[model samples]
Target: MSGLYRDVGVVLRTYKLRESDRIVVIHTKENGKIRAVAKGVRKTRSKFGARLEPMSHVRLLLYRGRELDIVSQAEAVEPLSPMLSSLDRASQGLAALEAVDQLSLEREPDPRAHAMLVGVLRTIAAKPSPLNVPAFYWKLLAHEGLRPQLDACVRCGDSEPSARLVAFDLVEGGVLCRSCRSGQAISEPALELLRDILGGRLQSALDREESPVTHEVAALATRALEHQIERRLRAVAMFERG
Candidate 1:
């Protein structure tokens, strides 16, 4: 591999290196997820300083190396300064970035995931709503093959509108009907909204305001994702703290 130039990408995470350098993980439209070293980025006067911050979108000229690529130059595509100014929104944005970092593999291109991340970041930067952030999580998890079945009961596949009990089984990947809810716990309203979310009804779900159903859905989605990933995100704890 030789030197290559790529268009802008969103910085997902960054770690300080020796002296004045850092390693950055970014999701690019052209190259998927990439890990590269941003030389001298930590220096006070470094031109790349702002461009390498997490959540900052940047265009890069890279030099492919044996172990990792080197970020030769970077230009900020979106500053995202206002978004990072809010601690709450920043926490959520970091969590989302961490989730993407955990879920994506090196060098593998996932256009859907890329687009979703970009969209989620934009939403956070513009509005910073907890509701939208959680919904974005649910959607991302679903796109990565962890979608919970909410339309019909997981056990019986029954499609009724009046089922009071809606049990979600992490191992089962969906909800269980009333008849099958023998030893299960569930929130009916949450399950119903989850069904709608899985069915691409975001506007309706968001229109419900600050309903308990939304919280339940967010909780359920978080639990389901943790179960699948086998690790709780550090950012979740920070988000809760704030």
Candidate 2:
């Protein structure tokens, strides 16, 4: 299999290699995450110069190499121009890309992960919301089977409709009831927003504008994602500072 193969993927990140070549990390629909060298891509007239940029959804032809795969041909399925039009959109979009890069494993075939990445990018391009990136993070965590329990306490099996849930434990992976109150303090509105995010009411949550509740949700989601990835995302930090 040391020859040409084709795949569709989203460019997760890229780095400089030599004088004119670049290393691209892509999350593909079939082969999962791959690192490939785009030869001479930094040159002015390189065919794949623009096609291989981070956040681009691309279809590629690659030649298997002893070490890094070589990108032979690339075509853009979805360019990231729309999402990069503004600081707000770009920041959120880039943060999501970093999340995908962190969560994806090399050579692991995860079609669902690929689908989710493309879906979120398309959503951000069409309608950039404050909730979009955080929602993506939460959903990604859920897809990875680390979904935080929202219906009841993480400690006790309290499912009463009026059971007091006051805080979220990022380490424990769920909400804490009044008796087991710890971690980030969760307001009633914030808790409801979390439910809407994980409980099949995503559109409703996305339509709403930014507020204290959204901020709380974003913070919790960011912390949880950082915990899962075991490192800080540069894009998320920059977006927050900006």
Candidate 3:
């Protein structure tokens, strides 16, 4: 296991190491999430510095090290360009990366998670939407089997169609009927938007323009994801502030 291995992954983040090196965290197709050292990457002339930037998708050849892997070679597959140029898209993309980093276990092989991250970056770059980040959050939660219950009240299993679901409880993990109402107030449109995101009407939901309902859904989705992960996503705050 102390030799070279090849993989394609998106660089989730990077930090300074020694004078001319960096430590990068990436979520790979074959190896899941990994931490590796990129030597000489801080210098202006370093060949792979841009390729290893956060959100850049690259194919890598890395030498397995005892504590960390060494980047042997890197070729950019999708450079971080257009996404970084727009503040909104950049923050959303970073939030997605942060969420993946939070959920991914080091060296765990999860191809679906890798694909989801890559797809999200591509989506943010090519077709930006207010719902894109929220949709990603919901889809990721669903994949983790932590999806919020929508068909019936999570508390007391109330399924009366006449009883309107008027609230959402993050801790309880679902919508609540009028009787069980607690936590944030939720509108019918917001609930329908949540269902659309998780129930195969994703395209329509994503295509809808920015509205109060969409904003409500986005806020709910962010809170739900943060609740599950139990950490505030810094990038989310950056975008919201911008």
Q: TM-scores, in order shown?
A: 0.91, 0.96, 0.96
TM-score of 2: 0.96
Q: List the candidate 2 regions with Cα displacement exceeding 4 Å.
A: none
Sort the candidates on lDDT, descending order.
Answer: 3, 2, 1
C-alpha lDDT score of every prediction, in listed order: 0.77, 0.89, 0.90
- Report how far residue 72 has shifted in candidate 2, in Å: 0.6
Question: Could you give candidate 1's per-residue lDDT for residues 1-242 as a string of tens digits?
Answer: 44776656889988988999899898877788898999888889997768788888787888777777889889887777866778867877887888888788887888888888888788777766656667877888888877776677777788666664457787877777867864347776776677676677876765667667777777776776677779987787766786
lDDT tens readout by residue for model 2, 1-242: 64889999998889999899999999999999999999999999998868888888899999887888999999989676897798777777788889988887899989998998899989898899899999999999999999999888998868657678888998878998888888878898998998999999999999989898899999999999999989988987776687
Give the Å shift of residue 97 in candidate 3. Answer: 0.6
Give the TM-score comparing model 3 with the true structure, all chains together: 0.96
What lDDT score is found at residue 240 in candidate 3?
Answer: 61
lDDT of 3: 0.90
What does the lDDT come to for candidate 1? Answer: 0.77
* Candidate 1 stretches greater than 4 Å from native: 161-165, 182-184
* Model 3 agreement with the true structure over 32-143: per-residue lDDT tens digits: 8999999999999998868999999999999988999999899999768988888788888888999899988999999999999999899899888999999999999999
